[model samples]
Target: MTSPLSSSPAWKALLAHRDALAGATAADHWQASPERGAAFTFPCAGLVVDFSKQPVAPETLALLCALARERQVPESIEKLFTGEPVNVTEGRPALHMALRGDEHAKVDGVDIRVEIQREREHFRAFVEAVRDGRWKGATGKAISAVVAIGIGGSASGPQLVLRALAPDHEGPQVRFAANIDPAELDQALAGLDPATTLLVVVSKTFTTEETMANALAARAWLEAALGPAALAHHVVAATSRPDRAIAWGLPECNVFGFAEWIGGRFSLWSSAGMPIALGLGMAAFDHLLAGAHAADLEFRSTPLERNVPALMALIGLWNRDALGAPHHVMLPYAARLEGLVLYLQQLEMESNGKRVTTTGEPLDRPTVPAIWGAPGTTGQHSFHQWLHQGTEAFACDFIVVAKAMGSDPDRHARLLAHALAQSEAFMDGLDVPDAHKACPGGRATTTIVLPSLDAMHLGALIALYEHKVYAQACLWGINAFDQFGVELGKTLAGRILPAVRGENAALTPATHHLLGIIHKLAQSD
Candidate 1:
C-alpha cells in the first residue's frame, strides 16, 4: 500500500535529493560554500540554532520545507494555536499553548481566558501566602520546604523547570518523589521537617499508581510527624479531579484544578506549576510563560526556512530518515539544565515514538530516534570517547548558555569553547596513521546557543522543542498529542501486582516463580 506522505511530490523530491547528496561530507559542503554556517543558522528570540554540521545542503532543507508544505504544517500549527481539535484521536485541542497566557484563544466558543485569568489569580494569591509566610502549617509555623509527589509528566515537567531555574529560586526548598519504591521517597524526605514541609500532589487523574502511592506515603509521613489534622495545613492538590482530591481528605481550598486538555508532559505552564511558583516567585513564573509566548509567536509567524523550531524539525527529519541516523544525543553544557534532556526525552519520544499513524496504518520510516544524554563536561568524560571514535553514527544537539549567571567569566568561556569544539570535532576529525587515534568525521550535530541560563531563555528553549515535535509529527502524518503507547505497561504491572502480593494464583508460572523468590527475599529482610 502506498502511504500519502511517501507518495507526495515533496517526499519524492527529498528522496531524489537524498540520493543526489550521497557520500558528501559536511566538511566538503562547507568547503564548497563559504557561507554555510551563517546560511544554516536560525534565530528565535535570543536563542540561535546552528544546523550547518548536519548533512544537509540548501536543497535538502528546501525539499524538507516542501515536504512540510505538502503536509500543510502551517495549517496544522494554526489549528494548534486556534484551539481546534488537533489531537483528533483524543478529540481535544491540545491547548497547552493557552496555558502560556499570551494567546486570546477560545475553545468550543467558550472564552478560556476567563478561567485562565481566574486560575492565575488563584495561583498568585496562594503562592504569595506560602512564600511570604502568611500561610502557616497546622502547628502555626510557616512552611519552609515543599515535597512534590507525582510521576511521569506531572513529576518531571515542574521538577525539570525547578532544577533549570534553581539559581533564581529564593523561596521554599523544593523536593520531588516520583517512584513507587519507598527508598526514593525516603531519600527525598530524609532530613525535612514535616511540620514546615508542604506536599503538592500532582496527578491529573488523581489515580496514577506511583504518584498516588508516593502521595499516600507522604500523607502517612506527615500524619506521623504532624498529626492527621495537619493534612489540611500542608497538603495541596493539582489535578483535574478536584472532587477526588477533596475526597482524599485535602481541603477544597487546597485543591488546584487544571483543564483535562492540558496533557501532563506539557503541564508545567498550568497550575501543575504550583511548585514552580512556590520555588521561584510567581513573577519569575510569569516571565517563563512570557518567554514561551515569544517562541509561540515566532513559530506562528516565522517562515519555515527562518523558523528555529521548524528548521530544527526539518534537520532532524533529514538526519533520521535521509541520513539513516539511529540515535540522538542531547548535550547541555550548563549544570542547571541537567534535567533538560529528561524533559525533552518525554516531549519528543512520547509524542512521536509510534509505529503506526493516527489512523492505525503502519509507518514506512522510523519515528523518533532513541534520545539519550547527560550534562556536559561530565558526559565528555563518559561518552565522548565513543561518540568521537565509535562505529555507530548518531545525530546530536549541543546546548550551551552564552553567559553564566555567577561570576567567573573564564569558566563560562571554557564551557562555550567545549560546546563549539565538540561540534567542530564531529565535522573535522583527525586523520592519524594509527587506527586507535584516528577519528571518523562527518557526524551530525546542532548547536543551540541560549543568551543565558535564565528562566526566560529556558522557557523559550522548551517551547522551541514543543513546536519542533509538533512540526515533526505533522510532517510524519501522526498525532503528536496522544500516547496510547504508555498504557499497556501500566495495565500489565497491575495484573502482576496481585501475583507479587501472593493474593491470586491466576498468573503465569514464570511470574509466579519470580514473585516467590521476591517474597522469599523480603521475608529474609
Candidate 2:
C-alpha cells in the first residue's frame, strides 16, 4: 500500500504551496483572487463547480492538480467505473457505479449491464405488484403505507431520497424508523393499518440490532391485530441474509440481495434501493443511476485541474487544514432535501473519521471535521445566527435547486430568495459599529445549484459528494472503504447488555452503586 502522496512530484508541489500559505492571512484577501479561480477547472455530471470562493492561490491550485495527477486519479476513477478493486482493505471492487448503466464494463467478460437490467426488472415487477392491487395482504387489503427499517446506509439513502423526492411520489406513503428507540417505532406504526402496511426491513445482514428491533416491534404490532400468519404479508427484506429472513418467517421470495462489494452508503443503486424504487418507480430509479453514471464518466475522463470532485476535495482540505476551519455544513434550501444533511454526515464522517491511515500509521493531519447542517429556512431560524456572527470560521455549503419543485409560484420565489439571500449574507455580512453587532464578512461559503429537484439532479448531487469523499480520502492517505471505528461501540454494547439485563456476576463497586440507584429510581417511578 504505497501512498500516492509520498513518492510523487505533486506531493512536493503541494508541500511547497502549504509552506507558502503560512505568510498569507484572511486580512490580506477578502475575495478569492481571479488568478486562483483561473488556475482550477471544474468538471462533473453536467454540473459546473465554482471553487473560486476558496482561499487557495493559483500556485496552490496547480500543486493540488499535480497531486491529483501524480496519484493517477484519472486512472483510479476509470478503475472504479470499470469494476476494478479500488477498495483495497475490503479486497473488492467498489462497483456501485456499475449499478448504473455500465454497458461497456465487463467482469470476467460478462457485461454488468445485464445484471443491472435484471435487478431493475425484478424491482419493477415488485413495485408494480405492490402499487397495483395485485400484491395483496393476508387480510385482502391494499397497502396504504410503507415502513423502512434499518440503520446507517440502508436507512439514510432511502430516507433522504424519499424526503427529497416526496413531491413526485404517487404511491403508498413511506415512513422510516432507524433508531433503536422504541418511541420511534411506536410513532412510525401509529395510526397505520396492520393489514394495509408493508414493512421493508433493510440491512445487508438481517441482524442489525436497531433494524431488527424495529422490525420485530412492527411485526408485533401487526400480529396483535392481524395474527401470526400476517408476518409473510407484512414483511420484506433487502439483505443477503435470506436464510435468516426465511427462518424468521419471511417468505424466501420476499428477500432481495445485493452484492457484498456494494458498501451500504453506496448501496442505494442496489436492491437496498427497493424502497426508493417503489416510491419513485423504475423510470426515476434509472434516471438516478444515469445521473451518477454521467458523473462517473466525467470523473473518469476529465483531467485533474478540470475535475469537479478533485477540486472540491482540494478546497475542503484547504478549508480544514489551511484556513483552520473545524466544521463543514451541507445546507440545502429545498425542504425536499431535508434529510441530505444527515445522509452526508454519515457518508463523510463515518468514511473518513479515522486517526490512522490504511497501513496502520497515525495520520499527521486532521482526518474529518464535525460534519453537520440542516435545511435552509429552518436553519436560518435556528443556528444561522451562530453561522453569521460566531467567531469560529466554519466552512459551509449552500445547496439550492434553480427552480422549485413545488407548484406554488409565490412559495417557490420565497424559497429561492432565501437560498440566494443566505449565501449573500454569508459572503457580505451585516455591518454594525459595536463589536457584538459587527459581522464577519470574509466567512467562506460554497453554493451548489441544481438545475431542478428531479431524480436525476438528486442522483448527481449525491454522486458529487461521494466522489468528493473519495478524492479527500486519497489526499489524506486513508482507506475510505472500511469502517472499523463503528466496531468498537458494538463490542462495548455486547459487554454492557448482560449488565443491563441483570444477568452479570460480580460488578465493579461503581457499577453496583449505579445499579442500586437505577433500581431505586425504577421502583420510585
The per-residue C-alpha lDDT of model 1 at residue 202 equals: 94
Clashes (N, CA, C under 3 Å) per candidate: 0, 1
| TM-score: model 1 vs. ground truth | 0.97
* TM agreement with the true structure for every prediction: 0.97, 0.91
**Which numbered prediction scores highest in lDDT against the true structure?**
1
Shift of residue 126 alpha carbon in model 1, Å: 0.2
Q: What tens digits encode model 2's per-residue C-alpha lDDT throughout 297-342? A: 7766667777777788877877786567899987888888888988
**Cα-based lDDT at residue 241, candidate 2:** 67
lDDT of 1 by residue, 186-224 (tens): 988999999899999999999999999999988999999
Worst 10 residues of 1 by lDDT: 1-10
Hey, what RMSD does candidate 1 come out at?
1.6
lDDT of 2 at 169: 85
